[model samples]
Target: MILAFVLLFTASGLQASKAASCLSQQQIREAIDKKQIKHLAAIKAAVRKVVRGDVVRADVCNGNSGLVYELTILSRTGTVTRAIVDARTGSVLSKGF
Candidate 1:
């Protein structure tokens, strides 16, 4: 029983880590730089307005249509904003302040 519990916990941790590793800072920046995912202009504009100590979390979200680029801006003051961009056209799909 103890061995089974340990295995289960280890497997769960590995799965979590695998998902986290899928989106890295460097990879997300590269995606933006290469324009592989859309909404570069809007994302850049939003980033510029972000206050100091703020950071952006980006991911390739798989929605009903397919994969889309989603960026979540987290400000130092705890303000949060979400933006979804088109993967193919780089257009702004949605934005919320």
Candidate 2:
């Protein structure tokens, strides 16, 4: 049980580290203008395939997995969900609150 707790804490730390390196809004806009990342609409559509909610915010991030779009979504009942999708392929990597 202690080992499991340590593992979970370590995993969370790694995820935080990746998120800490995400691009700023200005950089994201530049990437969009240069067509370096997939359109936000496409990224949303991809997340919708596996999750249900309305997107609140989306941003380009360099996650440990790859270049991704991190989105915050609000459900009908007000539950919030966060999703990460591959910026290039629009493939969802993870989704949860």
Candidate 3:
């Protein structure tokens, strides 16, 4: 059911359908400076607002629409979940995609 919910939400947009290539920390900083994507803090905050969990890891990756934040979260129940946030808009795109 959770997976179904995830798919339902992600199906609307935000395709990582292809192999998502992640950037290194240096590249991340460059992207931020170039205004290509939002700061990591903003991206992480966006996900935290939608998902009740601690963001353990966050990475900027190329998505179908544009840049996206790929986050690994540790839920209150100790379950690990992945989420995606739009880099520019800070919108939650996927919860388990």
TM-score of each: 0.43, 0.70, 0.72
Report the alpha-carbon TM-score of model 2 versus the true structure.
Answer: 0.70
TM-score (C-alpha) between model 1 and the true structure: 0.43
Which 10-residue window in model 3 sums to the lowest lDDT? 11-20
C-alpha lDDT values of all predictions: 0.63, 0.85, 0.81
User: Against the true structure, whose TM-score is highest?
Assistant: 3
- Scanning candidate 2 in windows of ten residues, the lowest lDDT window is 58-67
- Summing lDDT over every window of 10 consecutive residues in candidate 1, give the lowest-scoring window: 46-55
RMSD of candidate 1 to the truth, in angstroms, is: 6.4
Candidate 3 achieves a global lDDT of 0.81
Total backbone clashes of candidate 3, pairs 3 or more residues apart or in separate chains: 0
- Tell me the tens digit of each residue's lDDT in model 3 across 1-97: 9999899878744545433377778888888898988897877766767788888888778888988888889989998889888888888888873
Top candidate by lDDT: 2
After best superposition, candidate 3 residue 46: deviation in angstroms? 1.6
Over 1-97, each residue of candidate 2 has an lDDT whose tens digit, in order, gives 9999999999999878866888877887788788888888888888888988899988787777667898999999999999989898888888887
